[model samples]
Target: MAYKPLAHIPTHLISGILGVGKSSALLALIQQQPPEEVWAVLINEFAPAGMDALLLQDQVPQDAKVTFAEVAGGCACCLANLPFKVALNRLLRQTRPDRVLIEATGLSHTRELKHLLTGPEYAQVLDLQSVMTLVDARQLTQYAQHPLWIGQVQAADCLVANKTDVYQAEDYQNLQAWQMRAGLADKPCYLVSQGRVHLQWLMQPAVQEANKAPTPLFSPIISASSSSAYQAASITSTVRLTLSREQLAASWQTWYQQQQKTWGTHIRVKARLSNMQACYHLQAVGAEYQLDVLPLEKSSPLSSMQRIEVIAVAAKEDIQNALTLWAQELGILDEA
Candidate 1:
């Protein structure tokens, strides 16, 4: 037997804004993976606790040939950064996967990451494919002037309007109008619900050239010491505080209502919580929120611990204070 080099691994970047279903889309793609082919996923989350990985793990089949790694606490946009390079290199060497999926943090600018993937270092090892940017049709106007959002869209080879099941006719029209206004009307677009993207889309030729000069709307790559436009804080408790389903929702609503003005339009919160009767996953983007019950058997190990991650545009102190208040009201802090 002779040692053989692996073929170029197909790589895809799944980019999106806060709470736009990037994780769900990535999970859907993972579920569609062929059993024989090994796949690797790199997830970047603004929160240090990496709640997305936990939630995603709960849903992924235990027997699937998928490997996941997370770069938490900040965006992994810069290739020179040690964490990004180390995690990616480790995964590539360890798994030797057929494909790789990198999910950028919602607040990340993808231009640099895209450049890294297509750069000389990876040119021979990775086949950089379509850069899929997912958009929530309902928030087109809300993020119209946002630099991070603009950068992600500009770096995309294709666009996906996820969560289409909740969209009204006007939302679709706004998406079309925005695409034209952004000079992206000619780009490949898909409308899907619950991030149900077909596998073929990932194989499309990447039309966005990495060497092209970025538009003014595309913000500069974030630096280590530079102040971010957003603030993120994580709240964790070892004991699960008992509350009725209504009480938990009401508590969040009350806290959000108090901080809504300060948090502005960019607020997002994800949590694994429990009520008196069951455990649930709660996700809130802007003012809307949804809760889905989690199976006890799958969530038991984590059920005793409640974890919440919040991202907002407010000051870090303000974000922390608000979350603390919310936690106190919900009895999460008392146990902590």
Candidate 2:
């Protein structure tokens, strides 16, 4: 059945694996929401620590009135998805908004998430607008081994190949494979960067139907299960640590040199920290990363100490060691 426009609370489940800019996309959407409306969001994090809630809260206005519910510590597709359901239902009842957005953990499988929304239970409460899958055009090389990542692209109603600015000429071909998987060679798949998409891009194309759920290349039995391959760990401090830009750059480069070697992978690491110069938004994903200084007013609400989150496919001990060492090198004497 074709969904009636705005007949119920329209929901857009933003799906993508790590570093695809799902959070950045949500930030863009949040910035553009009608100033008078209340937007509710449900965020999922593979690592037990959830940073999306804090990150999102920082980007919105002091009085913009965005409500959030977060499910962390595991895959949202596990345990019959109780965590996800609980968060979504609670957010809806609390906010009672006309639209909702769920930013699933980067490792989430789209089929299971889609089923939760389009299922009979939520069919009346949620008007499934579309599933937007954000792909980092540069990361297409490693995606083949991550079956669930591809599964997400296959289930998307619209595909967005983000980070195009950094993509090479040959990378566009990845979209063809993605389109073929969805059996919608003509579907609205676009190339964009910086998580910016036209407002129209968010609306369902009047006639585009949902894609067939993907068949994972993994063992079929567990293919349907959304299992998390990453573990998250965090280190906090009572007060901000002082570090120079050069020091920050050097430490990050050192981590890259060590972690990018064979058998080591860092999915993502995010930190909001203050230096003598200014506050910065720092992030690392795979072999690439970024650090941007936020305007003073924008970063003013943050606490003195940085709250850091590290997501990795490595073992839990390795993740803790990596993060702890990172904090120490950054000049923090105590890791809270």
Candidate 3:
């Protein structure tokens, strides 16, 4: 059956695990939007720096046609999903865009978000075209990474295997098994790289994309009460750190690992810090983190002051507090 395009404004929700290329795909999709129509992108992140907002703003021209607002502090569904609605409604009311696109926090439960979108309150306002999930082919190569990605599979209206430029034989085999589990291979699943999804393809509403009924999106509180489960948080500190970029990178990784050993996996963390070498970007998922030198070259010279933003799942405040204490222990606590 041919998918029908709605006459109303289309709102797209792009979801994926952290570092899986949702923003990259979204940037590609937004660039294709009509130049004359006003398009609003409401981005949520767990960091105050709001890296996605910076990345998206950098790609899109600074014009009236494209407007952006950011929701930071934590994932959208946390805190009773209030902050998400407040920020989203504010963006929508203020922008009244011809189109609305929401890039949810990487750790957000897409099912929870979808429930909100289709619920009576928003159904009238949001012409939800689809929920697109982007996956990294490299991550699919691992057997253990499967559980981490299942939520994305269940909630997406389209499944895009991105970064195929790095695919190996094992990755393809793993993907086959994954797709079979998802029942999305014969649906609208696709393989692409560098976030090149066409905007038109995602807007198709009538296409039957998945073989199974929609999977449960949340487990009553996103497993909030489970002692074994993870909870998400944002940790920000502005302080003086004298370490070099390489040193900072190493330290961040070590800290993440030590915490993971004590608590659980650190889902993702993005930090911008100014050190003697330069102000650099630190990106981490699990325990691995890297310092990108290119952003440094374009960045301003380092000052004694560095503002750090961290987003991770450490389960309730007990772990979150410990992570905060760890950041302070690094002697980077900034009072300002």
lDDT, candidate 2, 1-336, per-residue tens: 333343378788888988789888898888778876778888998766677777677667778768877998766886469878888888887678767888988888777888778878887788877788888755654564467786777677777888888877777776566456536575577788889865457677222335465544322322233234466787766556587777777777777567657225546788776665666677888777887766556754664657678877667788788777877878864634
> Cα-based RMSD of the predictions, in order?
3.8, 4.9, 6.4
Give TM-scores for every candidate, taking all chains together and pairing residue i with residue i.
Answer: 0.88, 0.85, 0.72
How would you encode candidate 1's per-residue C-alpha lDDT over 151-216 as one tens digit per residue? 788989899999989899999898888788779987889999988997789897566464554344
Instruction: Rate residue 9 of model 3 by lDDT.
Output: 59
Q: What TM-score would you give candidate 1 relative to the actual structure? A: 0.88
lDDT of 3 at 317: 72
Clashes of 3: 1
Lowest lDDT sum, 10 consecutive residues, model 3, at 218-227
**What is candidate 2's TM-score against the reference?**
0.85
**TM-score, structure 3 vs. true:** 0.72
Give the lowest summed-lDDT range of ten residues in model 2: 217-226
To one decimal, what is the Cα RMSD in angstroms of model 2 from the true structure? 4.9
Better of 2 and 3 by TM-score: 2
Error of 3 at 113 (Å): 2.4
Q: For model 2, which pairs clash? A: none
User: Candidate 2: which stretches are off by over 4 Å?
Assistant: 1-7, 205-213, 216-229, 262-266, 275-277, 333-336
Stretches of model 1 off by over 4 angstroms after superposition: 1-6, 78-80, 208-227, 275-277, 300-303, 333-336
